[model samples]
Target: MSAPTITFNGTIPQQYDDYLGPFLFEPYALDLADRIDYAPVTNVLELACGTGRLTNLLLERLPSSAQLTATDLNPDMMAVARKRTLAPNVTWAVVDISAIPYEDNQFDLIASQFGFMFVPDKLKALTEIHRVLAPGGKLIFNTWGAIQDNTAWAIVNKVLHAFLGGNPVPQHLGPFSMADAQVVLQALTEAGFHHVNATSVKKTGLAETAAIAAQGFIQGLPFATAIQEKDPSLLPKIQAAVEQEFSAQLGNHPLRTPLHALVFEASK
Candidate 1:
């Protein structure tokens, strides 16, 4: 079985921001933003600033004098982000992490939220990040933990697997690919980042209803495309099953599920 190619196009970007943004991403975005020491950060770069969840928070924390360059590979995602975040000091660009466009040692801080795992070459991306980071600068990012560790996503994955019937899981190839701490640490070290630290952070994922949560998991993510490719007609059935599972396990009318992720911080 082969993983489906994940693209943040069409309505995926808007749906992602509308559904999963607050539920799965906002908590980690707050955590990532809070981890930064913004006193000396004049120039900042954010990679894969999906819908500007963390980018908005970063702007709030940063001083008026600070400049932020937020970039993502998908213009659709960036469009949503740009609409949400409007600041005079912020510059938006379409960027690929593996080959950053900025000059060497340019940014005082580089941050990403739940984006690194999707990079095909982790070491290459980290090296590019290190190159852009100024001397003694910091890099902070987070990756989702193993599927089983994130309770809500774990349940969703199980339901998806059952529906796919022995097909490859879309998330395994992207979001959860770098779940292992050792793998992340090794990549950072090899990329020449020092004083590396990894922290396991767990947060509560909230959704208004089981149905809505199911929609987020099924349609908002790459899973939607995978399911569509396999059998578009099965999407509704799988989503219903996922909703039922969520209601049974997590509850409805303000669903609160445990989500786990690994946060990494390194100095260049």
Candidate 2:
């Protein structure tokens, strides 16, 4: 199917934390953390802080004095994040990125990992970030590259497409939605960001076995939600088909596949 309305609920939060987090998100989370100079950042905000993979890294990397507010639109995801990440310096909130409730110039840095793709109005969301960021503050976010560059995702998409008889359901195709660098840069620049830089990052996602990779793709992310919406009865068949294809192509032992992302950073 195309994609599901991006959601993390019920078992999804746990599954996402267990499989997807390590497979695709942790590397970019660490990359985003390394881009920041935490010594000077006293206040930080993390948008779309799903299950807090990046939040934990930020807590570890930032200065002890720094305070962070982690927010996500999904309460279930935030609940999982709060349970996983415990710190006196952090406050959790359920927030809409386009309409931030904070005061002007409230944050020294705003970091979003694989979240901007879900924003319907990218410019409006960036403007909100720019509004709440202090002068010289930074915004660092990453979006996935085109499907062709992401091996596991591409394989899943192909398999799902074929299984669904070449008619994928209509839903939010999150990562593939924001693949244009020029458009992203323009949105940031228009939102009053300066010194904008876009870099391409490539990482190998490690899976102990192709079955694990297939499980992560089939049951751990929004694609699972899509499968349920389209036809709940097809889940087992889909999972088995994807697992077989992955095992045949990627091998069963220690599957490592390429994933690409476009990391964007700018200062206000």
Candidate 3:
């Protein structure tokens, strides 16, 4: 779903953390956590810590003395994240990234998973991030590439569009908004982040079965929210179609599909 249309409230957070988090977000979460220099970093602010997919890995990489403040726009997501990653060093809060409520230079590093694209005003959010970060602090985040680059999701989107008679919901079209590195780099630069760099990363989106992948797509994302809002009765039909599509195209055993993303790193 498009960033504007996607909202991880209600049951969406739990399903997202359960299905999509492990299949699509975990590898990148691990990679992003691994990039943390860890030696000197003491204060970290994780924006959009959806269900703590990255938080779980990040905790492992951080030194015991490090302080982590995890924030998300949705309280439902924060609740799930809190239960998943319980630690004395971590503080969980619901925060608006556009107007972050923190003292200047409060954090040494800021990180986000596949959430950068969701911000309504990226430069405003980045400016807030820059404001809260200490000198030479870093901002690390990732965004999905074009829809075509992520084949499985792309196919699901295509199927939904075709099934719904080409009037797919905006949530289905939102996540790929910042696919271009140039746009992201410009936003970061304008927000006062220096040495901005965007790197392409590829990972395998894996599920135990085609049914699982299909179910994950249907239930674990904005697809479910959209369907629930407009036509909840059509769920079974959509799920069946998605399963059949995956089985026909990707086969049933140990489903593995490629997903492309751009990892952006900038110094504040």
Candidate 4:
């Protein structure tokens, strides 16, 4: 499947950081950060570091001597990230994972959260990630599991597809495209990574209310742009449908739903 072109410019980045961060990303950020063996990692590289949710946690965990290079494909996203995470040891850059702008064998740790699935050339990105890691360095990242496994998003996807009259929705599917653990492991091995491991992790995704959750699902992602392009007038209806569905399946008043993801760890 072709990768969806999702623009992170304009107010989308802010909405993403404000609304989606706590609801969907923060829990996984904590999980990714805790999996790191930070003692030996003096130089770190974070790929697709959107809004610095994990960056902030990495800064807190890493030793003061370590430096973090947090990067994303979108500068607008990095702009929000820079404002959210501040540390002399952390440097922000606009970097495409397919073509990482860094020297080989430079970093002791390379990490990403919910970002790898969006890469169009998974092999090239994995190869680059392996090439840039120091010998014995670790690579850790996570991707959302199947859409059906992530209840809230599954509901949102169903609503979106129905609104679009059962048309193929590539934008919403990109994030969960690499859900299979074996597929990710095979790519990592082909990229020259060893001791590769994949784990299934499930966490609770939270939102203050179903309406707020629906708003984030509709407006806080690139899917919002797709909706706007398809029919700007349908946006409100779509949001309301998602909200109603969320309340029926998962209640409001601090809405919580199970989020499933696959975590991969490998050695270079």
User: What TM-score would you give candidate 4 relative to the actual structure?
Assistant: 0.96
**Over the stretch 216-254, how does candidate 1's per-residue lDDT look in tens digits?**
888888788777787789989999999999999999998
Stretches of candidate 3 exceeding 4 Å from the true structure: 1-5, 166-173
lDDT of 3 by residue, 131-187 (tens): 999999988999999889898888888888876654344542367878999998999
> Which runs in model 1 stand beyond 4 Å of their true positions?
167-172
Candidate 4, lDDT over the whole model: 0.87
- The lDDT, on a scale of 0 to 1, for candidate 1 is 0.89
At residue 149, candidate 4 shows an lDDT of 87
Clashing pairs for predicted structure model 4, backbone only: none
Candidate 4: how large is its RMSD? 1.9
Q: What TM-score goes with each of the models?
A: 0.96, 0.95, 0.94, 0.96
Deviation in Å, model 3, residue 149 alpha carbon: 1.0
Q: Give the least accurate 10-residue stretch of model 4, judged by summed lDDT.
A: 165-174
RMSD to truth, every model = 1.3, 1.8, 2.1, 1.9
Tens digits of per-residue lDDT for model 4 on 1-268? Answer: 2334766777788888888899999999999999888898899999999888999999999999999999999898899889876589998888989898899999999999988877778899999999999999999999988878899988987887788754234643378888888988999999999999999999989899998888887788887777777778998998899999999999989898999999999998
Best by TM-score: 1
Candidate 4 lDDT score at position 266 = 97
Which order, best to worst by TM-score?
1, 4, 2, 3
Give lDDT: candidate 3, residue 213: 82
